[model samples]
Every structure is written in C-alpha cells, then in structure tokens.
Target: MNNILTLAAIYRQSLFYFAIRAMTILEPQTKLSRNWHQKAIAYQLMQCFLGLCRRLIINQPPKTLKTHLVSISYVAWLLMHDPSLRIAIICYDEALASTQLRKIRQLLRSKWYMALAPATRIRKDKDTETLFETTAGGEVRALSVQGGITGHGFDVIIIDDPQKASLAHSETERRHLEELYASAIANRWRNPAKGVLIVVMQRLHVDDFTAYLLRLRKDTVHLNIPAVAPVDMTFHLDDDEVYRFREGELLEPERLSDVVLEELRTAQGEVHFQAQYMQAPVKTGGCPINPAWFRTYTELPKYDYRIISIDPAFTENGGDFSAALVCDVVGDDVYLVHGEQVQCDYPNLLRWIETLDKTWKPDLFLIEAIGAGKGIWGLLRERDFHHVGTIETHNGLPKLRRMEIVSPMIEAGRVFVPANAEWARQFLRLIGSFPYGPSDDWPDALSQLLIRLRDACMRAGQHRCRRFPPDPPPQQTSLRYGMHYRKYWL
Candidate 1:
C-alpha cells in the first residue's frame, strides 16, 4: 500500500493543474457577465441608451428603473430622432400612460443623459414638428394623443405601449381597443412613406394587440426581448410556467403568479391582463361610465325603452366613432342597456342603426341632431326606424357642462358600464386630455345623451336634472317693487 503510494503524494503536488482545469469550466468573468450577476447585456443596452441621451436635451429619454427601461428606451429613442410623430399610444389606463410620459421626462433629466450637451450649447428652433433643438442649432416638439394629434404626417410612428390598465380575458374591452385603432390611430397616419410602427410590449393574452399585430404585420420584423433569455435561443419560455414556441402564443393563466392569476380569473381578469401586458386591444380603464354597464353579461330579459340614443361623427376620414347607446327610463334612473360604436359612411351607419334597432327591439329612437349624427337623424326621419312609430329629436349640449351634469351620477356609482377598458379609458382620459382642446368622441356623445335624457326627464318631471332643474314654476309669483307685475296674479 505504502509502495503504491497512490497519486495522493505525487499528484497532490500537481494540484495547481487540476485547479486550472476547473477554472476553464467555471470562469468568474463568464459568471459575472453571463449569469446576470454583473453588467449583463441588459445593462449594456442601458449604457448605450444613456450614452445617447446624456448630452441631447431631446435625446434624454425618460428614466425608468431597470425594470421598465426597455419599453421606455424604445419610445425615447423614437422621440429623440423625430419629434413630429403624432402617435396615439393607446394603453388600457390613463394612469399608466401618463406614468410612461413622466418616466420619459425623468430619463431626460438624469445626470448621465444630460452630460451629452456642450457647455455653451443651447436648444433652439422649437416648433411642433421640430421638437428638439440641439445646442448646435436644433429643436424638438411634441404631438398629443388627442384630437389634434392627427394630420401631423409624422415621419415615424412609435407605438411603445398602447392600452391602459387592462384584463386579457374581457371581450368587451378588447372590442373597444380595436375600435380606437381602427377609428383613431389608423387615420393619424397620412404620410405616404408612413413611418414604421415600433411597438414594445409584454405578452398579455392570446388575442392581445401584440398577437393581433403578429398576425397583422407578418411582413414587418417582430423583436421580443424579454427579461430573461433561456436555453435554445430560437424558442423561449413564456413567463415561468408556460413554454411558448409559436410567435403568437399568449401566456396562459396557469403560467403567471397568483396575483396576476387572480386578476385573470375575474370578470375583469381577462380584460386587465389583455390590456396590461399582452397588448390586447382594450378600451380605456377607469371608465366610470362603461357601455357594458348598459348591457347584460349574462342572459336576462331586457325590457323595451321609450327611446334609443344615438350619436354619430361625420367626415370620410379623421372622424370620431358613431355611437348608439340604448337606455330605458326606470323610475328616476336612466338604465342605459346596450350600445355600439361604428365607423362607416353615412348610408351604412343609418342602415346599421335600423338593423340594430330591429335586433334590440327598442320602443323608439333618440338621436343627437349634430354633425354626422344629424345625417343619421335625418335619414331615420326620412326612412322611418322600422316603422316602429315613435321618434324623438334633440341637439347636443355644452360639452363641459354636460360632463359636469353626469359626473355626479358616476361619482355616486349610479351609472353602470359593461366594464369596457378602452371605453372607460377614453371616457376618463378624454376629460383631462386637453385643458381647452378636443376630446375622445364617445365621452362627448355620452354626455350629450345623458344631457338630452335629463332634459326630457326634467320636462316630464321624472329625472331630477343633475346640473340645473327648471326653477320650480316661478313658485309664489314674487312681485318686486317697480317690477312689472300682472294685475290679477300680483
């Protein structure tokens, strides 16, 4: 045994060679770089982005933490290059969209990004199109997502993230978002060379807009760089639980964690996730007044209403959606039961409304006598709505005053919405979108309907007008000194 003296003595003396071999298999540098333990690729991308922003004022992208930097960087990158891009980044919620904008501002203010500027350099030549003015005679500007955002003929269309707070599973919400894009965002692009649409988003659901685009823009490049990269670069894991091989496979409910899972299973679950990350075409979130509030999610008996409210927009392109809201007077409350948002030529809208009326079987039709709505109203008057017999006509009210009248009803939780995310989003966002500017069409139309209804109710002594009820029949017939007084009444 002693004579054999295993490699314990001789080989032990060459332990350094074994150590070197081990180093080859597990290198510290590789772990630090590849293991995400040190400055990983994500960090480098950040560095390059910050480097680009450090000096240019307009170049300074919004500064979000490492978590949100990816999407933020993409938007910042676009804004820095060309400021004329009038984009409607439709998201599920106003809070989230506003947050994104603020973050972009924060990135610009970061010490790292601000350093790119020359000491004596200053921004100049500022206008809507020329957003940024480099210290060396340059400028930058912005285009809002509201009414005037269109007609910019933007050279670039960056859809960093659309939709507000959303659920992936809600069908109603999904439809509303599709409407926004088809009606609003689609018209915004008039440039012949129409700038490329750059979208960066997380996977929300199967039918989410991301998936929609995956199918829609088959020719365009799709780049999805998630938080983590797994083995087999060609295929990636979706979240933690599910394996996604197909380009458009949505992250399933079981794959996500419990919190998100909870949101997934609820009535709002599908709508929320779909809009939040999956980029599902969804209505705006926080819509205190959702069209769904007027609808039945489950099969139930619906009673006929005295009138059906409809508001329509005019113009061939760059027009608001034509809306048809159905309501019945129940006691003092107006039960708005169902509605539709249509974008069609004049004839088509009239035809469709008549068809919808037949299907819904409402008692009568009440339409806004303004703009495109007047066309439908006129058409309905000429053709007769299915010869149902009843017809009521009304004009739009002051937009702001109308909203003020309805706000109380929303705050009191009296108005029921079908839980539409995009509708709610546009409803809420539009109110605050412009201090003194145009708004999302649905809200304006909705306000008009409520105002018209309230007026009708007030005249009938049914609904107490939220804003101004008629002064009680000149109660007491007050006769002031020197004032004209009727001989008998006074």
Candidate 2:
C-alpha cells in the first residue's frame, strides 16, 4: 500500500512541478515567490527538454535565483524524467560548479523528492560532489569554464555565470572564455544536431560572451527579463501563451519592492543598476568630456605643426589595442586628421609607427611612457626618429581626472575633426562613452595630444586661439552627439 502511495505521489513528468517542490526544500526558510520570470524560464527549459530549443540564452538581473531554477532544480527534474540524460553544469570556477552540485545533490536526497520519485535513486558507488549517477543511468557532471571536457559528451550542457563579474570587463578574459566555449563546451554534446546548450546569467558587457554567441549564432533564442520594464515587451512563450510586461512594471515586486530597487539604483549608480539589474547594459555618460563639444571641419586650415600621439598596447598579445591620432595644430584650432586602433604585437606596432611617421611626417610624436609605449619610444629613438617625445605624467592622476583637465578645452571648441571621416564615427563613439567604452586607446591618445599641445602653446606664448564659426543647424543627428548637424569650416 505504501509503495503504491509513493508511486502515485510521483510528479516526475513536469519540470515546473518538480522545481516548485524542490524549492520548498532548498529554500526552506524564505518565502519563495513564483513569479513570471520563473514561469518563463521553466517554459524555456521545457522547450529544451522537449527538443524544441537547441540553443537557449537567459539574460536576467542577478540575485534572482536563476542558477537554482535552471541549474539545480531543473537538472534534478530532468533526471527524474530521463535518468539517462548526460548533463554538465559549467561555471566560472570549480568552487562555483561544486556549490551548485551540492545543492542538486541535497535536493535529490530530500524527503519530498524521494516521496515523489521513489524509483529514482542516486547510485551509492558513483556518488560524489562534482560527478554522480543515478540507478537508472542518468549522470551529472560539474566543471569550470576553463576546465577541459575530454572524453565526455553531454546531452544538455548548462553554463551558469561562466564569467566572474570582476573579470567580465577584461577583453583578454572575455576572448579566452569565448574561445573556451566554442572549442570546449559547444562541441562536447553527444549529438551535434539535437544537443541542447543553455546559458543563464546577467548581462555583463555589450561584447561579453552572451553577446558574442548571439551574434555568432542567428537561431539562438534569447529571453531577457529586467528588474523594471523599460518598455512594453511581449515575450512569446509559445503559439498560444505570452508573457507581457507593461512599461515601468517591476519583475518581482512582491519580493524586490520598488523602494528596494530605488535604493539599489541610488547606491550602485544608474549606469551599474541598469546593467546589473535592468539587463540593459548601457555605456553610462558621466564622461568628463562630451563628443558633441568638438566641432567638425570639412578641410584643414593652415597648420604650423603636425603631431601624432600614440598610446601603445600594454601587452604583445591581441588584447589592448595600439591607438594613434594624427593632428594638425594651426594657431588655437587643433584639427584631428586621422585615428586608428588595432591589436598588434610589438613588431606590427613598430611598423605602424614608422609608416604613420613616414606618411604624415608629423613634426612631433607624443607617446605614453608606460607599458609597451616605453619600448616603442626607445625603439623610435634608436631608429633616429628624433621627433618622438614621452608624455609628461602628473603625479599619477586617474585617467578620468586627466581627461577632466582637458574637458574645458574640448567644450570650448578648440578641437576640430573631419566632418564625415569613417574613423571619426568610431573615435566619437569611444569618446562619447569615454572611460566606460570597450577600449580606452583612442581617448587616451586624444587626451595626451591635447594636453601636450596646450602646454607647448602656453610655453611658446602663442596665446591667440581660433574658435570655429557656430555650426549651422544640423540636417541629421550627428553620430557623435546622438543628433544630426551640418559641418562648418573656418
């Protein structure tokens, strides 16, 4: 009679049911709120389980129990249905991977779970923290993102927060992880055509792995849920059902009240809050200088001096980019002639400098005296490039502060740039998003040029500065200012 009762109580078919039941055991003390986000994720996982979604990406605010829902409860649920499902959960490191593994192991041993699925039991001989198997042939593996997955093929691979928040901004780390996923995780599926890959994490940067995968694969389904809805977003769960969120609506108001969110927004700053909680990663605009302040020029005016400022990459690896800006300074107006940023080794960097020097024939060259810059500067001197000069440092002020000192000059229209140059768009984007943009090579070079120019002019007693005529009403939004404008020449 007890065996029949246990078999009758088993709810092994529905992942949502199993997740809710497991949640009661995992988060025993807290009052868990089953919100819309959970339902949406459950549906998406169900689709993956049913062989509908091959590649799934979940982008949501952090501290929302995503790992629990997708990695632990969901995996346990899947095992109950098909104990033969080979699963691997990958995280930033072994510790994180093991943490989730422990949770799933605990949930599997809970009395509620045993009562529901009495037939499913973890094999005692194969039981371990990071790897385990069930009596019915299912297996679960936990490993780090950088760890190798040799001789192992998984039916469903779940990558939970594959990157640490601190390292997400590093291009080298991002690239390494992206390559790791492509070479290691993505190809480890037992069946290439029918295998499932699910990634769940908060959006870190615009160029992070999540963005990279979305760009590389066109068919991947992306589900994004922000803390507060920015617009009326209709999430199509299926042909008949939809999860619609009205503008300004909170994702889980019952648990994360508006007051709590507002406090977070205040404490963390709007830029961070938007990226970390709203899932809308934006390059915040507290930059000391605005790109709109610099006037555009159609043709170069007479120039007394041509100068090129170089900010060399810190490493030989293809990580930080080497940037060079060519400028023509006539009186007080500094015209930006050209700019370029490229990932190159020291040899390529030296070749690039020699080429720019030969082509532009700038009278002066200013290079930052740190990292690879110092070596490049020495090489230029050894090669008899007498124009090269190291930029003077100011008592170790932050980059933002150094940029701040030049903000007034930029805002006063002392800098003139080509109106429709192809490179100008990229330069302006970097400047507009200054200090926060993906790369700082351009901004650093530009700032170095301006500061050196100002100091040179002041020392030479060339006090007269030419201000370009007022720009005509813009015909279209200027890419630099997020609005259109017409160009003017002095």
Candidate 3:
C-alpha cells in the first residue's frame, strides 16, 4: 500500500488520482468507483481550479458526489500543489458553507494528506471552522453568497449550490442572487485574468444561476450531466478528449442504477424528477395532467370509435402551434395513437390533417371551434370532409379551463398512451408542464380528444364518461356559422 501511494504521489498530475486518494483517506466508507461522469467533472474542475480555464459550470443530478469531489476535496488538492493559493467557498447559506469547511478541515487532518503536502500546515493563529489559514500565507474562507466579503479577494472561487431549492422559482430571489453574483462575487478576484471560478449545482429552474451564467458567459465551459442522457451530446473536455453517451445511457448507473433511477422518477414524479434529476427544469407546477396517471399500452385494444382532434393556430407565425392528436376510443378507455405540435399556415395544416385522416381513418374529424380553428372547420366543411365535426368551446373558456375538465379522465387511468411511440417523451414534457409550458397546443388537443370521447359516451348512457359537458352537434355547412361560432340558444 505504501509503494502504491508512492507511485500515486509521483503520478498526482491527474485530478482523478488526487480525488480518489483524498477520498480514500478522508471518507473511508466511500469505495473507489471509477465513474466516467465523475472523472470528466474532476478533469474539467481541475482545469478551471488550476487557472487553465477561466470558468466552469457543472449541472449534474444531486447525490452524485458532486459537492464531495468538486467543492470539498479539490480545495485540498489545490493546496497540495501551491499552499499559498488563496481560495474562497460560497454556498446558499453560512451553515452549508461551514459544512464544506469542516469537510476540508477533515481532509487536511488526514495522515495521507499530510504525506502529500508536508509543507502545508494550518496557521495556528487563524484556525477557525469557517475561516482558516495555512502556514504558507494562503487561506480558505467559507461564506454564503449573501455573506459580505467586503475586503477579501480570492485566487480561486467556488460557488457550490448557491441558489436554494426552496427559492428556485421565486423571481425576486433568483434575480437578487444573479445581481450578487454579477456585482459582489464575480468581481472579488485577486487577479482578474488569472483567477478561476467554478459553479456546481443541480438545475432547479430554467432561469437559475447556471442558465444566467451560460447566457452571459458564452465561453464558460459547461458540463450538463443529466441522470439519463437525453441525446448524443458530447462533453468536449479538451481538444483530444470528449465524453459521449447513447440516447438513454445512465450517467452513473453504479451509484444510481437504472432500477434506482426509475424509483426516483416514480417517487419524485415527472415535474420534480425532470428538474432535480434530469437537469431540465422548467417553470411549472404539477400541471393539469399528472404523468403518473397516464396509463401506457404496448398494443392497442379493439376500438369502435376514433377521432382526429385538432387545435389550430391563429396565424402562420407568432402564434401557438397547430397541434393534433389521433385517438381511438375502446369501451371506456381512450388510447392516444399519435400526436404532433407544428407551426404552419392554414394550407399546410389542412394538408397535415388530410394526411392524418388518410393514415388513421378516424370515424370523425373533431376540430376545436375557436380563433383560427373556426377557419379550419369552415375549410373542412367546404371541402366536404367525410364525418367532420366542429366542437364548440364552452363560453370561449380559456384553454387552461378546457384542459382541466378532461384532465381527470387521464388521472383515472382511462387514457392510454402508446408505449412505443417516439412522440411519448415530448407529450410527457408538455403535459407535465401544462399551461406553464412554452405551448399549450398539444395538451389542448389532448383535452379536445378526451372531452369528445367522454361526451359521446355520456350521451350513449355510459357511466365511464363521468366528467365533461354534452357534445354539440357538428356544423354541416360553412355558410351557417359566423367568424366566431357563438351559441344562439345560450
């Protein structure tokens, strides 16, 4: 073991070696596991910590040992190389900052660390928990982002989890933190050009510090490690080094295996899981349709009725998408066969609907009677589309209200989604965010489909269609209705 340590000490140029060695001594319970995600993070963090890179932003899932390696252990590694390198650590609060300070202190006390950096000794004079100094004129100060460091400057600064999760969606709090980062924290470097800054945290919102920094600092190196890899994006560590993963590859399965991650997704639900574990936080709540309530089907059941639901855009541009969902109703259950959200003019939308009708051969074409949707209904009626129907929007209620009326059918496990469809992921994202999402077209289209199914079933005396209002008769003539299909009787 001594000989191995001697060799490791000689080969301490690699940050991975340094991190594992430090962890081995300081955190004995942590077994040495060679996770690729950790290795990539350590390398990039070391580059920034060593002043090779000016800034680095790492957005990874929580409990991935992010704070342990990047914030706590790396500071000790820096001291080993240059004991006089001044460092400052900032977190959401002073208590959290002190926790990291204690971890660093523990590492510095390890016998292994003593052998690695024999010249570095704690300055007996300033050896407090939150603020400490080494004999070589260097110091590590731990403070919160709001904690004033008026006269202090650091050679390397680490902002670890600066934004608290509780205040993630508060606009005022988020903006205030951004202001402090720009004015107070960003400028407090001893040497501006040579100083290093590292940000490590899970994504809590779309406008969190990570997003703000990336938008402002285009040159900042970013490492976004989602729990499940979304696509084939490569992490360009350097010129010759890159880390690539398949579409659904798990980031760190050894520590967070597929089974474990699935449990997390189930426990946290889609909204929280996407933000905390998936690193794709959006500004939204539980949304209208809870993804957990969506029943998935590997194969479709026999259906007596089918409809192509449409929510048309108001214009060719600068409006919501012209969304559509092809649905099949079998008994009490409604199955979503296909779904899409696209931007197109009336002509294009007509063509797209024609293609869907040809493919699905739905019994009726159910179009929402509102805005540009009125035009769609008119065109379909004029063209004599077989089995075309115009469903009236109740009192011109908001799309949100319409969606709420049909959300319970989904929650009751009466709506089944195609398990193998490529559109499933996008559909889940849209429904998970609902009205707060960028576009409400997809969910609206879904609501239209489910409402039509339920209303039709209710008229036939089927108790399965418990929610929603009565379905209005489909308009038979284009010349009968005006621009806005107002109900005459009501």
Worst 10 residues of 1 by lDDT: 55-64
Measured on C-alpha atoms, candidate 2 has an lDDT of: 0.78
1 or 2, greater by TM-score: 2
Tens digit per residue, CA lDDT, model 3, 219-268: 99988889888888777544478878779998877778899987766545
1-490, model 2: which lDDT tens digit per residue?
9875654455565565567767778888877777777878888888888988889999998889898889998888887777788899988888888889888889889887777667778899998778988898878999987675543788999989989765665567889998888788878988888889999999877678789989989999999899988999987555478888999999988767899997776545455567679887765236966788889999888786677999988456568888999998787678999998877777877888889987897767789787777888888888877567787664555677567557767776778889999899889999988888898889999888777766655554554533323454453223323532211121
Kindly indicate the candidate among 2 and 3 with the higher lDDT.
2
Question: How would you encode candidate 1's per-residue C-alpha lDDT over 226-319 as one tens digit per residue?
Answer: 3222222332112122333345332232334446444433423333333333333354333333333332223223432334666666534656
Off by over 4 Å in 2: 1-10, 236-239, 283-490
Global lDDT for candidate 1? 0.42
Task: After superposing candidate 3 on the true structure, give the runs of residues whose Cα lies further than 4 Å from its correct spot.
Answer: 1-11, 146-151, 236-241, 283-490
TM-score of each model, in listed order: 0.32, 0.59, 0.59
Clash pairs, model 2 backbone: 83-138, 474-485, 476-484, 477-483, 477-484, 478-483, 478-484
